[model samples]
Target: MPRYDFRCRECGSTFEVSRTMNAASDPARCPDGHDDTVKLLSTVAVGGRGAAPASGGGCCGGGCCGG
Candidate 1:
């Protein structure tokens, strides 16, 4: 089961929901009778501290003595 984000135009409400793929395929309409409701493109990311650090260069903090 994957959570999805939906945007409601009738009430301008953007909310998240956890449901099955079937339910996710067919999203429910806005309770306020707004047909403009649509699924928003989003990705579920995990920002955690841990694992291995980057061996390459990144922004200001990269290789030795970046000026």
Candidate 2:
């Protein structure tokens, strides 16, 4: 299950719901029993190891130089 963030316009409260991707667009009710809600754009965080930093600085500290 994926968590989705929603904001209730009636009470101006934010809440989260866990549901399947198929039902991601479904309307969510707030904890205060408010039916008027809108899904909020969520940010995805990626974890795990990425490319190691360049050893020596060449251009832009070798970070963007792909050294």
Candidate 3:
């Protein structure tokens, strides 16, 4: 399962949910009980991009050291 972040337009609430990739695009209900929620764009720390690379890294992963 993968985690997804979502924001509710009706109540301006933010939340996270764990679901299968296939269902990742499905509409999510906000924790505040709002159904008008949209998926939030998340930042993935790919190797060699985003933040500074680890001391022994091949890509920049904040500190994940994926490289």
Candidate 4:
């Protein structure tokens, strides 16, 4: 399951929900029991919290200099 942020335009409230990827884009009902909710664009951090920073150097990380 993945967490998704939703905003209810009907009530002007925001909420989060954890659902299967299959239903990630499904319409959401606000806590106030309102519809017209929309999914928010989220900033996803790969590797979870406190994960190690990616190693390697070079602009492209391939060390080929992109040439």
Candidate 5:
């Protein structure tokens, strides 16, 4: 079972859950017994587009090969 992140809307508590993919369709309530928990997206998504270069400066000592 893969783990997914969830956040409790009532208390703003983040948690991890392990269950089958189908379980994500109807998630369980928070341990506090409130049905205000919502699944959070992957960290990669929060970082936004990631196709950018690794470094702003060239890697080959500015030799123009990478500069």
Candidate 6:
């Protein structure tokens, strides 16, 4: 299950809910029992090492300068 963030416009409180992707658009009630809420756009964090830089004899390292 994925967690989604929602903000309650009635009480001005933020909350989270865990549900399936199919019901991601479903309305969520805040902890304060506020039904008027809107889902917030969340950011995903990716973890992993970046790709190694290209190696070559050129200004851009990829032989762009005809090295």
Per-candidate Cα lDDT values, in order, are: 0.76, 0.90, 0.84, 0.89, 0.76, 0.88
- The lDDT, on a scale of 0 to 1, for candidate 2 is 0.90
Model 2 misplaced stretches (Cα beyond 4 Å): 51-67
Give the per-residue Cα lDDT of candidate 5 at 48: 48
Model 1: colliding residue pairs: none
Please write out the lDDT profile of model 1 over residues 1-67, one tens digit for every residue: 7888888977998877788987886866766767678899886676568656656667556666666
Error at 12, model 5, angstroms: 1.0
Compute the lDDT for candidate 3.
0.84
Between prediction 3 and prediction 4, which has the larger lDDT?
A: 4
Cα deviation in Å at residue 21, candidate 5? 1.2
Error of 1 at 35 (Å): 2.7
CA error at residue 57 for candidate 2, angstroms: 9.0
The superposed Cα distance between candidate 4 and the true structure at residue 4, in angstroms, equals 0.5
All candidates in order of TM-score, best leading: 2, 6, 3, 4, 5, 1
Q: Which stretches of candidate 6 lie over 4 Å from their true place?
A: 50-67
Measured against the true structure, the TM-scores of the candidates, in listed sequence, are: 0.53, 0.70, 0.66, 0.64, 0.56, 0.68
Per lDDT, the best of the predicted structures is 2
* Per-candidate RMSD, Å: 3.9, 4.5, 9.9, 5.1, 7.0, 4.7
Better of 4 and 5 by lDDT: 4
Rank all candidate structures by their lDDT, best first, as comma-separated numbers.
Answer: 2, 4, 6, 3, 5, 1
**Candidate 3 or 4, higher TM-score?**
3
lDDT of 5 by residue, 1-67 (tens): 8788888999888888888888875675787777888998886544447665555566554567642
State residue 9's C-alpha deviation in candidate 2, in Å: 0.6
lDDT against true structure, model 1 = 0.76
Candidate 4, residue 18: lDDT: 96
